[model samples]
Target: MKTPKFLLPVGLACATVLSLLSAFNMPSWANFKDAPKEIIDEVWQVVNREYVDPTFNNQNWQETRRKYLAKDYKSREDAYKSTREMLKGLGDPYTRFMDPKQYESMKVETSGDYQGVGIQLGLDEKTHELTVVSPIEDTPAFTAGVKPKDVLLSIDGRSTKGMDIDQAVNFIRGQAGTSVALKFRREGKPLTLSLVRTRIELKPVKYSLRTEGDRRVGYIRLSQFNAYAAKDMGNAVAKLTREQADGFILDLRSNPGGLLYASADIARLWLSEGTIVSTVDRDGQRESITVSRPAMTSKPLVVLVDGASASASEILGGALQDHHRAVLVGTRTYGKGLVQSVHSLSDGSGVAVTIAHYQTPSGRDINKKGIDPDIKVELTKEMAKNLKADQVATLADPQYARAVDVLGQQIAGMPVEQVVAAAGKPFPAERQPVAAENQTPVATP
Candidate 1:
């Protein structure tokens, strides 16, 4: 899920005030017989005021608005179509238009509750194809054996050739118990699967203390950075710390990021100081966030990431890596670093506009170029299929086992570079010693 910009505390407050004013006041636009046109104009005004790119992808914004407004929209559907066309000119798939139902479904998703096959979808930046980011663990899609990097060919037998992410989402999600047929291109081979949609109340954070030889290791798998992710993560860290856990492995594999504030808040849990992340707005003004309070835990930490880790996942991983706060293991991340702010139109419809681009503390813009792990472990499809939810964090999971080995070295007061196991293969660890200026105190195991 792309982080909902306006849902953050300050933005939410501003939105609340605007909503209240719009509700009570009698607006002249309310009486427009062609109210559909009003929506088109509203979307235009929003993009005019808030889009991250002042050039609007080098298009003539006012002229384009004139062209769209000149058309006589027959219905709300017609206006929606025109609005989508208008947004598409910016050439950003992340900035999308959603109808009322799609908007509501998106809201439910950030709440960590929704009805669907439980798959996170993405548009490939390079291929321009609708791709599966990852499947939510133990959900219908995951159980059905859908894998990451899978290209979605069609939905319900309809071609997905030119369909945008939101449109494909509408086709796949339905009332619980409903079924949708999805054809995917994996390994250049066509494979089809049918999944029954179900109401998914996702638990954003799952943690347990594991006994690895003589060390007590805390395992926390963060599946999403939804609304409740920060609180749940804090609770898990505190509980594990109370249990005298020697170190921690924070698994962010396949965690399609959630709310922006959630990532910032979760970063505060691990980082006592240093920049969490920073954003550059349309005018080039930069905003950087850092936690002033003490962290929840200072024990040695290692992070697990993969190709499906994106957006806020990249944000958190980048911040920690740059600050020398944690050692990362696995493949590079899913590069989706642009920030979006979703807005509800006067009508029930909504629009997600790309409002800002962010950077890590070290000033790395991990947009298309994702952050690389210190230890690169290529988990093949066969290995992934065998590593179910129950097997994760266990010896059966190579990535998790690799992370455990790194954390073990840290607990033993050894440099991270000494650890050399990737999926049981002798791989060179890319861990660089913490920069002299970036060192922070941590508890020794």
Candidate 2:
């Protein structure tokens, strides 16, 4: 919900867990000997006290802890396995354990820089296989021809059949100049690609000006909502406005959302007042409310989103859509409305526990149920292939083209509400009921 202001500095993925750890004067684990129980107790205590669902999803958390606590851990790995098993019972994917290495990697990524082959991975629930969510544009993976929905068969020749998402990522990531061989199945055909890992410095926001039917549209692509997201977007919008751009298209196509405050700050650029998003804690009480400030640039806006758009991305998009500030184009969002607060452990390891569930301005719970686009446009197989091959200009992207078209017809100085009304969509006037206490926040990534 309302993380300490300090936690809001970086991307949600890179929130400062160490700060929280330091405040409690947590003891350090010098070694693994006799550390299993302490680590387990720390996790259990945090979840017991702060988990968003106070009922522990209707299960007896005390008993659950007893079940794990009764086990005799022979080593650190055994303790990790037991802790993971215990968390699995909660059925929340976003809330999980991260070892020291994984936590460090997360910190690097959220800092908007990392040394790795850039690609986002997820677990396929039904098949229990690793899948490629998307490749960071222009990264080693994207340049090597990775695509969304590609089934990862192996990493560096090791079979990935049973590997978790974190394991797969670790295996694929390496120092700059080193190569990681990725074996994947695409279109039912097994294929292998050798990608040389490198330093990935993410310029989260990229912009361009496109002319459609004599109208200049500012096209801003937000790859991730990291620390620089708001400032970068503000600069892009300001420059575009100076260039006399009549409309704006905020592209969040493959964006896996980042920091909470980053999203709120970006929303403030458009919305002058009213709630942007709200977080409800485990006790069904409001934890924090992010409201809009003065408008930045009120140019007619369209937000482009796809299934890969999630978390903070959903927050920004949902807020604009609810306030009639932007017409959402493309498919539904990835829907990750749950909030995770990372906490460091004494062993340099960490846990990102779900502390609250976020609601859009209209009070809609978009956890598993994502926000639908006002106009739907699917990226066809042919279009995707052509676009990937650099055969089509980004202006030819079906979704971008549609957004430009919609914005072209909008009156340049019309109010956002009037623009939505002209498109035959009714702007929501009231917030919906808060989510019920028993509602589970579990979902596959």
Candidate 3:
């Protein structure tokens, strides 16, 4: 999920009012041959006066409105499509108007599953390179040897360069049994791979119990907050408790986040009965999302984050940090405070529009300003090379080490103050951006 944009509060309120007034009050024909003339007049007046660019197309609003209304296109939906075209005339990609159907599709995107290729991708804003974060297990990508850290070059024959993240995703996914070829690079070696598409059932949450030295740690890596995230997390916690796990390390690094409800649901597993997050709409109507006491997870916890952590990730991290439920350690999170609504269209297309802003439990706005770690620890390239070069026991990632250290503080009965004091200083390093490819495989599904 991407960070939402926040327009001026006053501007949003005014726009909401205008949208409601324009969309409501339709032509009610009791037994007439056509829609009443009042409807056309209403649309014409609103379009002529409220449209940002009234000098648009150099065409008369009343004439255009009449042309549309005379064809039995006088419903609220018709007016909305017409208004959308007006906004599209502005040539702004971010500025969009989503109808009810498109909005519902977006909601389904957040909460439902569909058949498609299975790879999680991340785009470098500066380089415009798309990196493969991870492949969904048992899916085509995973089956075809796609791995994390591989840079995606193209999909089918289309280059991903200049393509938006969502646009790229749409190209990669399709109906089951359909094939897409991808060109990618790994460690400077160019390669082409083709795989048959299939339904991807992403288990966003993964957990394991391990014995590190003398301590027992429960590790859970959350990639995204899918609908069943909370259930998976609860099961992990229960398993750990049964196994007498001494501490917990919740890894959320590079997690782009998902389902706002899923994030709150996961947080409820740790937080007591209270507000989890607050959403304030354009009208200042505040909706407080709270957790029940029965859902709280009572264990020593440490949550990990990095630049890729955003949206729902920030929500969970912020909630845990505010309640002191977990000690966050790693780079600052990806700041994204906006909430979006995805509306579907009649023609099967959809639009995602920013609607509101969200705040952490402590009332902090993390949009564009990510959450700072309580104990900041930067992962250096040297550490990455060391782990890749060494035959260390289970993966010795630097961020993981820091998380274990934080969790150890409580498990070893050490004072939180001492643990905080033991945190190492930051070490900044430059890492090369991942590369992209051009040609796709000849054989694709």
How far residue 11's Cα lies from its native spot in candidate 2, in Å, is 9.2
Candidate 3 error regions (>4 Å): 1-113, 121-153, 161-166, 175-178, 184-196, 346-348, 385-395, 414-418, 421-445
Better of 2 and 3 by lDDT: 2
- Model 1 alpha-carbon drift over 4 Å, by segment: 1-34, 381-390, 415-445
Question: How would you encode candidate 1's per-residue C-alpha lDDT over 178-225 as one tens digit per residue?
Answer: 999999999899999999999988888999999988989999999888
Which stretches of candidate 2 lie above 4 Å from their native place?
A: 1-34, 125-128, 388-393, 412-445
lDDT scores of the candidates, listed in order: 0.78, 0.75, 0.62
lDDT of 2 by residue, 297-370 (tens): 87789999999888888989998887778889899988778888777777766677888888886788898788
Ten residues in sequence with the least summed lDDT for candidate 3 = 9-18
True-vs-predicted CA distance for residue 304, candidate 2, Å: 0.7
Task: Sort all candidates by TM-score, best to worst.
Answer: 1, 2, 3
**Compared to the true structure, candidate 1 yields what TM-score?**
0.87
TM-score of 2: 0.86
| Per-residue C-alpha lDDT of model 3 across residues 1-445, encoded as one tens digit per residue | 1212222211111111113233333354333323334333443433344343344446665456546555545565675555555444434333345444443333444443666677767555346588875666557886787866688888897987755445567677777888889999988998899888776666777888988778899888887766677788889888888898888889887677766766777887777655666666555555666765575357788888887787788888888776656778888987767665432333333344455577776677787798988788786666645664232224477777767767877787754444655665332111111111221211111
